[model samples]
Target: MEMALCNIKNPNELWSLESCDELEQYGITISVCTDIFSTTILWMEADNNDGDPSVFLNHFLDTVTRIGGCPQRLMVTPSRENEHIATTQTFLRRNHTDCYAGEDSVMGGVSLRSHMWIHTCTPWKICFADLRELGHFTGKDLDKNLIQFCFLHIIQDHLEEFVGRFNKNISDHNILRSQDDGPAEDKLQAVLPEDIEVCRRRCTPRGRYPCDETLFEYWELIRTENGWEVPVDRFTALKLYLHLRNVMETCIDEEEQVTCIDEEEQETCIDEEEQETCIDEEEQETCIDEEEQETCIDEEEQETCIDEEEQETCIDEEEQETCIDEEEQETCIDEEEQETCIDEEEQETCIDEEEQETCIDEEEQETCIDEEEQETCSDEEEQVTGLLQ
Candidate 1:
């Protein structure tokens, strides 16, 4: 961007001043003031065009005086006495008697500002479009103050950029008029702001007049109230942007918390299902072991019952054989008793027969004793021997 200088060599010299035609587009009105001597853009303003005209004119004069001494004369477009610009001119003439102000056509029926507009208006249309695209300002009912608040710095930057480009190149009108003056490049003149002498050096007024207060204070005031209204200035618009940013951050935090809760619940359900599966498997194994034990006990009981039945049968057969042998021994003792009784009866009968014969022989021997005593003694001896034999 070109460095700005108030190129006033003589503070008392008469200077001519004029402005380009007002360009209004996209709910903004722009006006530019050019110094006739150096063809420099001394002041430019972008606004809603509804402000008090007196306020605007005062700021313009103050800005001019700050950069250099106020111009000696000022020329404006033709207007009726009742219109805004004409009223402002009347007001200036009434209050400030030092400046000689009149219409541009006053100089020999030729407008001084008509030729300057041809060069100035071309770049302005392009700048306005660029501003719209960059700011995203669409539709007819646009929020003019919000756009200004957001993009005011960008507007100033673009103005500086245009100043740099415009100062380096020669205008087409000047090129045509200087055709006889050799090459067009040689005719180009660089008007640097540093080279110009002025009464003082101050900040540029192109984008500085809109807002002057600190924006942080404005935002704090609105946040403390926790409420909003349609913004009437740049300060209020900035506060609205900050409030909306806080709300968006809170919503994002809540969404993350809800997602975490859902993940935890899903994991809990999976754990419960696995525990139930483990229990079922243990019960099934217990049932199988019980069945195997019952089958073994049944086999042992059957073997014990078969051994008891065989033992009882063997004891009954041995008892029957012992009773038969006892009965046969009693019958043999009875037969020996019967044979001894028959032998005792036969001995008693033989002894009784011998006793009867001895009695008869004693009676006969007494009768015969008188006759033959001697022969009887000898015969008795022989008979006794024969009888004994």
Candidate 2:
């Protein structure tokens, strides 16, 4: 007897058979067989008492092919089992023909579609034509199921590589949640006002130049766009604070160097003034010594004149009045010399007082400069403290 089972024209229709026994009662033992690609299942008779099994199997496959199934989807079966209890165990067994034939084939593309339906709750739509254009699928006129399967496999491979290589613990849901939270810039601005103010003040007036507002702005852009939150973690916040503090310290150091240079210049000026004063004292001393020498020469000349008058008196023996007159002139010149010496001594004492006064003034100037520098240092320290806070 020859029989035809239901004249099924499509694999979809043939897959509706629930059990092999349904066909077995009619002397048709049906088996569920996967295509070479394992993309879909097809029905074939494993045993036919009155006909060749291969002829029926080939006819069934030809019908599938004519109905638009690709040969890659309906080629030699890897394994076969009765439809009712067929499992993955039967599919992987080495005894089956074509079990190792397509070993190097991309199975991910073939199995991805059905695997998604079984393992995932979400339905994803993919375009095979687009994938083909992108060079992901090289097969000409591929099926939708195969495309979906291939795209799913591509996603799986990418995710595996990303997780393994990048060590990212984030998921799609987390990304979606972050986006829903709104722009990060607004969040950053809301938390950074106080810190910005502090940094600005530290950079202004006290610093050599104004603080770079652009640094803060650039940081804000990066932080917001990269998904970093405001009021950042403790470690990152500390790092930022330290950076600002370092900038402030650099400004402080420059200012200090300037102040020190000014102080050094002032000290140098003071030393120059003292040197000029010493030179003046030396000049005055030389002038005084010259005046003393002139006075001594005058006294010696007066004494010689007195002695000449006495000798003339002795020689004349009657000129006593003239001799007394010369002696009185000599005494008057000596008194004038004594008065001039007293005046020079008084002038030297006055010069000494002036020099002491100049010394006091220099000391006071140095003290003032010291106080000013201390105040400047204190102000800079306070500014740094405020910035850190």
Candidate 3:
């Protein structure tokens, strides 16, 4: 029923551990174990206080025990935290678990796994921040327990929602896609030519580092040899997770549905997909492509589209959508109000279509009528005569 991937009996199953800081405002941290092959977060918790290494170790031990102890192999990361990393590695080793730690085998450790955590923490932190702000968990003398009481279950719901969305979301093949002949590294080098040498040296198999070919083949062999039923695709994983959740009676509480915004007026809610991909921080924006502009037009929502190259704003007024084209100095409205226009070409003023009788055009373009049925005149040089009728 647990979100686990490693089979202790199977001698080839492996998983990796990574801890990242979360909710600094509330003194919380998160540690997660992920399936190396599937890249799914198997276990996670956010109760660690003060970034203490022992707290992570305790969680690791609890997770290991729950999963029946001692998988075929375990990889721990953020090697800078030498205390807990060393302790966890030693414990795994003592239990006959192939411990991959520090700057050892590239397959089971660090470099590749670190990328997953890069954008992962931001979304969770943002969610926590929103909850704190909305719930008014401010003030210096506020009780810590009260804050946790209000936010913990809600945050857990968000986490579970995120996990469901993340694991089930189909991955598109990008520059980071794994390949046998170093396609990922090649693509990376092509994009980041400055790090070409670093990519070559690190990506290439040498010493304790095993090639991608070896790792893939080993996993395939182990699965085939043991006849282990592993979820082959994300669809299968999603189905399995749903079934397990049902069987285990795990669900988000009804009270956790705390409204963050007014229901009637909220234009859009931050969905799980958006949270996972949202990059609002300047530091995080570096990962986004500099060449690609993020101004993607949502035609479904706006009823208008911008042709940036031609410097044109195309408005479809059938839906009564109004748009102003700044480039052409034009105003467009629905058919009902098409008469209301300001034409810069002839220095002319237009009146509302609803009251066309009120607008009188002069032969010399000297006079105009306002929407209020007042008569006004314009000089040849486009000066308002202020003639009252």
Per-model lDDT: 0.46, 0.41, 0.43
Best by TM-score: 3
Give the 10-residue window scoring lowest on summed lDDT in candidate 1.
184-193
Identify the leading candidate in terms of lDDT.
Answer: 1
Number of clashing pairs per prediction, in order: 0, 0, 0
TM-score of each: 0.32, 0.20, 0.33
Q: Give candidate 2 misplaced runs (Cα > 4 Å).
A: 1-237, 303-389
Better of 1 and 2 by TM-score: 1
Query: Model 3: per-residue lDDT, tens digit, 109-182?
Result: 45344455546656545654654676533423222333343344444555666677776652332224444224
Error of 2 at 307 (Å): 5.3
Question: Candidate 1 or 3, higher TM-score?
Answer: 3
**How are the candidates ranked when ordered by TM-score, highest leading?**
3, 1, 2
